[model samples]
Target: QGLRRAAKVQAGQKVLVIGAGGGVGTFAVQLAKAFGADVTGVCSTKKTDLVRSIGADDVIDYTREDFADRPRRYDLILDIAGGRSLSHLRRALDPRGTLVIVGSERGGRWAQGVDRALRAAMLSPFVSQKLRMLVSTENEEDLQLLGKLIEGGKITPVVDRTFSLSEVPEAIEYLRGGHACGKVVITE
Candidate 1:
């Protein structure tokens, strides 16, 4: 909600999601659509259909193409995967665009999310785009909205695979392989 609020997602703005098939990215896509923005999702070739199924107006197969390199610019970017460097992501955005960096893979051992947020802040003053990190606090009202969307069939959680409690090792391996179509949930 912070990103959507800060960017002021309007009825016709263009939003880009870098990892549309993942957990947070999936929510980002739906929320953007619900907020009335035209959303474009970027995921691997294997997740293209999954991204499209969630109401993204466009899905870019990152395995085959760099959506960021395209001539099209976005008004807001919810970068769920910090795969691209700061400068590269900025290139895909409009001069006054907002970049919401929400990935934590780079900071290996400690305070992963914090490190990314700090880096974004450090690079902010020198750039034209409003680069920042997102931190969502789920409240009752928003959860109610999310619940309504799920119950109403406007949004659905994509479960890539379900694993028994004893098979957690295998589930971890599956996620590490990077081919899981959606969320790998472990149920008792």
Candidate 2:
């Protein structure tokens, strides 16, 4: 819902989601599809099937190809796996497209992904495309809306693995390894 709300996605818009096999990316793909957009998911080769199964019109294996080099441009691009430069991402966006940076996985402790997001904000006004960052906010209204969508069969949560409370450390290690296919859950 955050991505949808931030991007203001519309019907028939071509949307691209990076890290589509991960937790947030998976939800973004389903939400965009539910919103009636033509969705494309980008992930590593091993996770292509998972992304496609979740309703992506197309899937790009980042390990096999660079989505930026593709001729096609998206009306909206969601960057959740933030390793690429802002300039590289802009190349894949339509001139008037909107790019929402959902998360960043780069840099050291001081700035990390925040630096790239800041750069995007600084550069946005000078460019034709809309570049912005998303900090997800939880509220009852949005939760109710998401629940309705889930009940209506428009969206479904994807849980890749579950761990006991005692396994929290291991769970974090697993996530840091980047092998999980979807959302990780911790249960008591």
Candidate 3:
């Protein structure tokens, strides 16, 4: 929804998905490609291969390279669970591009990433680049679209691991350790 509705992804446009190996990032990468955009993914070194295998045209290892330092700029950028400063992200975004922040787990408990989103909203009117925050509201309409996309083989969810119902604590720990390459599931 963020890509299609918010960023208004169009064919052949360069789209970058930060944190491309995570749960939401993996799907964002696939969905952007399915929408006919050229997708670039940013991830840690350990997840580079997974990102590429999922159809990213380019994968940047954030450990070794800063995407903002590159000469190329993206028409749309989805910052998923990333903590990069707004200025840093803008350097890699086209002047007229759209930047969408999705579910960042940064900041303290009180503000809890809302600070960045609020700042973005405040700064948007003055900037040429559109800086927006995506707060996903689940609805059947979008779910149907996702179902069709999945049925058509345009997108595939990557499940990194699954834990039984009794192993919830272990599952949570695994996710907190930041070792998951994709979605971690707790099965009943």
Candidate 4:
């Protein structure tokens, strides 16, 4: 819902989800589809099938080609696995599109994507496109809404692996290695 709310997604819109095979990405794709948008998922070659199976109308393999270089332009772009710069992302976004930066895996110790988000906010007023960052809010209403969506089969959580209490370290290592297909759960 964060992606949908941030992007103000409307039916029949063109939506692109970066890092569409990961935990958040998977949900984003499904939610976009539920909103009746034409959804495109971006991921590496190995995860393309997973993204496609989850309801992405189109799947772009980042390793093989950059979506920004393509002829397509999205009405809404959700940058969940942020590695691209604002300019790079803008290239793929429609002139009046909205870009929502959700998270970034790359950055210095001080701040990850926070810096980029700030810059986007500062620059938004000067540009035709809208660029903003998403800070998720937890509330009972939203939780219940998501629950309904899950119950209705509009969204499903993807758990790639689960580790017991003793295997926490190994689980962290696996996450750091970036090999997990989806969410990694730690069980007590």
Q: Please report the candidate that would top TM-score against the real structure.
A: 3
Each model's lDDT: 0.82, 0.90, 0.91, 0.87
lDDT of 1 by residue, 42-137 (tens): 998878888998899999998898886799999998887775777788889999888888756655445654676667778878888888877667
Q: Write the per-residue lDDT of candidate 2 for residues 1-188, one digit (tens) a residue.
A: 44667789999999999989998888899999998999999999888999999899999999889999999999999998888888899999999999999866656455764888888888999999999988788899889988999999998899999999999999999999877888999999
Candidate 3 has its poorest 10 consecutive residues by lDDT at 104-113
- TM-score to native of every candidate shown: 0.88, 0.95, 0.96, 0.94
Where does candidate 1 stray beyond 4 Å?
107-116
Better of 1 and 4 by lDDT: 4
Off by over 4 Å in 3: none
Pairs in steric clash, model 2: none
In model 1, the worst 10-residue window by lDDT is 105-114
C-alpha root-mean-square deviation, each candidate: 2.3, 1.4, 1.3, 1.5
Candidate of highest lDDT: 3
Give RMSD (Å) of candidate 3 vs. truth.
1.3
Q: What is the lDDT of residue 128 in candidate 2?
A: 93
- Candidate 3, residues 70-97, lDDT tens digits: the string is 9999999999866788899999999999
Off by over 4 Å in 2: 108-110
Position 159, candidate 4: lDDT = 90
| Two-way lDDT contest, 1 vs 2, winner | 2
* Per-residue error (Å), model 4, residue 149: 1.1
